[model samples]
Target: MKAGDPGDCAGYRIEFESSGPLLRVRVTGAGSYAATVDYWRQILAEVQARKPGGLLLVDELQGPALTAGEWQSLVDGTRQQGLETVRIAHVKPLGLQSVEHCEIYAREVGLEARVFDNETNARLWLRYGGA
Candidate 1:
């Protein structure tokens, strides 16, 4: 699906494309923590149902930075939602330095996740364990 194809998805515009072993997700909207998590669960559901090799999440949501607690909660929720089995490459939203913290929290909990400033690197990491 295209980015503008959807009107609103749980208060966010989410597009998903599956290519080979990768499930590419693009999320764009003025987002909040709760709404973000809701869409994330939807993405997780798709991943669980499809059983893709990896996930590339391009998050362009504009929102206030999440607190440390919120980041931990997101990571925990992701794990609890059964995404630990797949590698996740999260494209950090512009100006969100807190994404690194999210990656750290995810790694701490044994989630195979990484954060990147651009999609190229993210895709590279997802396809191959390159830095």
Candidate 2:
């Protein structure tokens, strides 16, 4: 589905594409804190339900940075997929230093997560499994 495709997926836009063993997820336009949490809950459930491939999260949202509880909720919700050793690559939003904060949190939660300056690099790393 395209980014503009509709399915009552909260206020954010999410699209998933697969390239070999890697999964590319493009996210744009964030919503309120609660809405954002709900969106991730649904999207992660969908992604995990299908296949938990290497995840490339191309976030273009400009919403507020996720709070500690929200981030933990995100980690917890995504973890329900039972994904083991899933390479998580995130494309940092423009001017958002908190993107790195996400990386830190993901790692602390035992997820192999990294932040990239761009989508291309993020996908490449996910495909290659390293720099």
Candidate 3:
């Protein structure tokens, strides 16, 4: 669907658009590990169907940071979904728990993904490799 079409996925609000170079997804609402997994699984289904050039995920979930096990599960799930085939830039506001380990693990799994604190930098990286 184009942007602004919201759907409830595991109690999270997910909106996505595929009309551009990147599939833009915005996620909001309370966060939980199970919800997070379902969120990505939905996104993975979209990616497989749409085949966008890249993905930009703007996350605004309000809750405790994911545990280490949760992060590992996420990374493994993405790898299994063949998410490494497409570039991804995930943005969460600053002051949230850092996701450096997640990024590192994603890279180790061959996923071209990065976590950013803002959307401008995320878009720049998705478009120009951060120039």
TM-score of each: 0.88, 0.77, 0.89
Tens digits of per-residue lDDT, candidate 2, 12-41, equal 777666666666667666555676666566
TM-score, prediction 1: 0.88
The clash count for each model shown is 0, 0, 0
Give lDDT per model, in order: 0.81, 0.67, 0.81
**Which 10-residue span in candidate 3 carries the lowest summed lDDT?**
93-102
What is candidate 1's lDDT per residue for 1-131, written digit by digit as tens?
Answer: 33324446666788888888888888888778887787787788788777888999898888887778888988888766667788999896586567787888999999898988899988888877865
**Cα lDDT over the full model 3:** 0.81
Local error of candidate 2 at residue 113 (angstroms): 0.9
Error of 3 at 128 (Å): 0.8
The model with the greater lDDT, 2 or 3, is 3
Q: Evaluated with TM-score, which candidate comes out highest?
A: 3
Alpha-carbon RMSD to native, per candidate: 2.7, 3.0, 2.3
Tens digit per residue, CA lDDT, model 3, 9-98: 766899988757689988998888887888888789888877788899988987778877778878887766757678899899733485
